[model samples]
Target chain A: MHYWRDGILALPTTSHYLQLVILWSIPINFLTKSYEFMLSAKKIIKCLDDHWPVLETLVGRSTLGSFSFQDVQALIQRHSPGFSSEQVFREAQRLLHHEVLIPLAKSSQLELNRAVLEFIQFLTQEHQLGTVGDIQSRIEDLDRLRGKLKAAADTKDVSEMRRFIRLMDERVREVVKHFRKNESAIMHLVEKAKADDTKLSLAKRYSAVMEAFDEYIEPVLQMIDINAPFQHSMQALEHQLSELILNIEQTGFLQSEKEPLVQLRTRLLDMNQIGREALIRSTDVLMPLREELRKNTLISRNASALLAHLRKKGLEPTLEQLVPKFSSDHQKFSLGSANQITSYMAELVDFQDEAYQMPEQVDPGDNANIRVPDLAEVLKSARVQKANTDLSKWLAKSYPQLPVDELLFLYQELSRAPTLKLQHLEQYSTLEVNGYRLTLHPFVPTATSGT
Target chain B: MQIELEQLTQLAEIHKKLSTGYHVSEQDFALWQELDTNEEAYSALFTALGNQLKRDSRGYFHFDVDDATVNMGKISRLFALTTYALVEFFADQGQDPLRALFEVEISHEILASILQQQYHLFEQLEVFSATDLKREVMNRMLRYGFAKAQGEHFKLLSPVYRYLDALMAVDQLAEFPGESSTSSFTSNQEQADV
Candidate 1:
């Protein structure tokens, strides 16, 4: 075994170069000079192939280039059979610490290996790489080698294990160094991609905010009455002042209470200034197009004054009185009937027509001593009698030339008496004067007992 | 009279067919069979009964059995068949009766059948009422299809063509055979016993 080991060690370093030549050669017959070259290449290739573990360690460190612990273990398992994944993994770990594979720091190698495995897993799962047979085969070969390294370490083959560990240490260092360089570049690219993604998302958010403002806010602003801005501002100010007052009251600080009140007054003054500015702006905007409306405002002020007077007095003014004292053209108003003065009066008084109610007769006895004549009795007593009317008709027909007012005065004077009958007033139905008939209805006071 | 009875019996048969999976009573079947044999008598009786189904100014048929007018039961029976046949025919033409029923004034029974046939409307049936049916019909007439209920009123979804078409068809059927010659018809009569 020691002689075989020495022979294996003495094998030409050029053996790998010869193997490379054989690997590069095309198929050829044994009779050709090319066949002699091929034959020499084949012997070297066989020697290297037979002692692949030794060649792999030497070449991996000097020429084949370094590999990760995983890759070194994979190579080990590939060249030597009967190695478990657990053994390969353990040996690979020991090699990584010995610095035989590559010159990487142990921590850096471990981190890079973990990252690479994670990346491989992501690629396999996310990109659906399991369907590819080549990738699967490579993964299996690497896993098997990892197992063999683990097994060698477990069996206490200290020299073989140390050699294996040193080989992996060198490979791991190279792999980690290579990965570190590439990782920085990849990191820079990823950072740039993330920045671009952030910019896109920010732009989308800005557009969405503008769209929401346009769809929801712009229409709402348009629908609001122009006068409402001032009203809303005033209301908000009032609410703020009220809240401030409440807060001050709750704090029970006398100085603070005064402070809020002063602040409120200042705020009100500021609001007044703002209102003036707004008013100026509105006047500037409206004056060019609304001269008629401006004129109408003066008339509306007068009408408002009149309405206020009526409301203060608690009196319902008639439509005649309430009508604005303006020309018909100036009075081009559109107030509803429900708002009219007459309608207001009718509602206020609750008036009903007396014609619909039952009539009540007055008794003369009730007012006999008061000297107040009965209005109803006076209307009833002035009736013309048909029998006395014949003489008055004859006199009216016979005395067409007499002055009516004079004849009626004479008739009234003749009919005057201390005791005048209610029926005697009907006798002077017609009195003729200046060819005009005058019908005199004389008043007679009815007799009443002295109270 | 026999023809009127036969039509009523046929309606009853259709109702029975829908409700209890039966066709007609023994008496109704015998009357139908007898009426089926005499086409001239049946036609004459149908013409007379059709004349009585004519609407007055109020747009309602004045079916009075005492006034030699169409019996209310006969008119109702005829109306039921015509409505059912219409629903079936519209359905066959790829028009969903539930949609059409919602488009016109129709009773809950018809709507229930429509719901039974079309499961999509089963959930909506619980919310509908008799008043809703009347308003829905008028809305379809005035507007066309189903309208959103506004307090007591309903607005139509489409034009009033469906309502006009249904009314016209019913009116034409009421004025059947020789009754078409008459321009005016009596209305506002009491409904007869079912």
Candidate 2:
């Protein structure tokens, strides 16, 4: 009896050592054979622990709680070496029968949880983020990176591709985090920008206006020299200023009296003054200066007719030669340069003759009878004359049906007597002879009445 | 089709009387119905008769007959002439002595009665229906040696008045038959006949 009691005591010690051996062997087997398998098993166990309730809820039963033990055993076995698929299956059956393994429905939930946990771990470890705060901070870091990427894209800088790739990775992590929490708001923001046609158009217009101003107007303004810095800037912005003025006029943005454009105009005029000064300063020093002088002489002419008319009207008649003073004060002329002035006047007369020379008058007698050609013919001739010879030939070939006469008349009216009134055509009434009225052509009637 | 035509004729007569600003009587409508079977014929007769009966330019009938400006007396005279001319034209065309003479003579009596009843009703009224009537009357008028309707209105051939006067004289002679009452009536009747 004493011996049996001692053996029992020794058996407990051996059992303890055997359990320790199994525990030690497990880790060694995992480390030596399939570290990845061991990691997967731990991951699955952690997933189950985290999502136990979720799995149960998805399974739609409380039965999954009893299966938790079986889940742990299967996961442990799954990590062990020398375990056949049959052995794993038998273990799963035992747990399932005992309600230790969750239902198939709960298993699916567990698998999804495992995937999410893996993704989360990947994101945290790979991107160097530990929490939501870390994700937020990373996103802030990405802003500058994203701007650089955009600039690189704009400049087509191939050297920045690696930096862009790093940025893309970080951006993916940030986007995933954002999607998890504020998916709806982010979606709405994207959709709103996409759907709003007006906003899109406005954005385009704003960009286009900016580009146009930069290209066309900026260079012109920069070339001009101005004393005032503010004026120089304004001169540079002339094109934009003009555009603003046009917009104000066309849209009546100011005329509604809500937003007055006078302030804008005043600003523009100030700008113009600066621009003019700058232009003057920037003008080439070697450029020739122009000097013009004029002298006034009053002479009495045949005004007796006008004096008589004024006397008849009981009014005093006074004649005065009023020569307005020059508005610009750049220079002035003094008296006593009569000889030089006379020579200048003579030159001025010669210049005037050259500049204001009249064309020789056509002799009407040579063309007078002119057979009083058909108005239609006259109009056709006018059209032909107005059209370039090449264009006229092309038009004649292309539009044979066009009323040449009418076109000529239109051309003549447009060129010679633009202000001709329709009332001129109404002067002739239908002529009655022997109780019969004749319908004369419009031109004929006008011509006859005038005659 | 016949029923529609009859309805149309009635409507036209109603339109005509309404156009004249006159309250048509049942007897007058019956007389108008008896006068012509054809709707087009009736319109012509009615239009012509209206022109004859309403002498003043103030009423709807004067407006209908004289689209342009006309003095009341001239309208009255034109109305008289129109009625007489229509009756004569129809009589000559139909060659129905009784109906023709009857139409002519009745138009004169109708005028006299209408004038006696109220002359002021035929003055200063505008004719809004001339364009429509002119379009309607031209095709038929073309057959009768009458001038085609012109300028949104109809103008009677000048010779029509003479034909109407002759018809009226014949009718008056037939109706009076030796009643030599050389009064204003006889002279007026004679003028109408002439």
Tens digit per residue, CA lDDT, model 2, A31-120: 233424333445444554644443333222221222344444455464544567676666445433322233446443222222332233
For model 1 chain B, the run of ten residues with the poorest summed lDDT: B185-194
Question: What is the Cα-based lDDT of residue A165 in candidate 1?
Answer: 37
Please give the RMSD of candidate 2 to the true structure. 51.2
lDDT of 2 by residue, B116-188 (tens): 2112222212222333223333333332223334444344443233233333332221121111111112222
TM-score of chain B of 2: 0.23
Write the residue-wise lDDT of candidate 1 on A1-451 in tens digits: 0011112343224333332333233223211333222234444334444444533343313212234555566765775667698866665554443322333455333222222222222221111101112222332343343445446545734455445434433332222222222222222221122112122442332332233233322333332336644345434544544554564477663333345344443434443343233223323322222222111121222222222222222222222222111111111142432224444565669866566666786765522353322323322332222113333443334434334543454345424433324234554554445545456564433433111
**Overall local distance difference test of candidate 1:** 0.32
In order, the first chain's TM-score in every candidate is 0.13, 0.18
Report, for candidate 2, the interface RMSD: 54.6
lDDT of 1 by residue, B42-62 (tens): 445434422112222312211
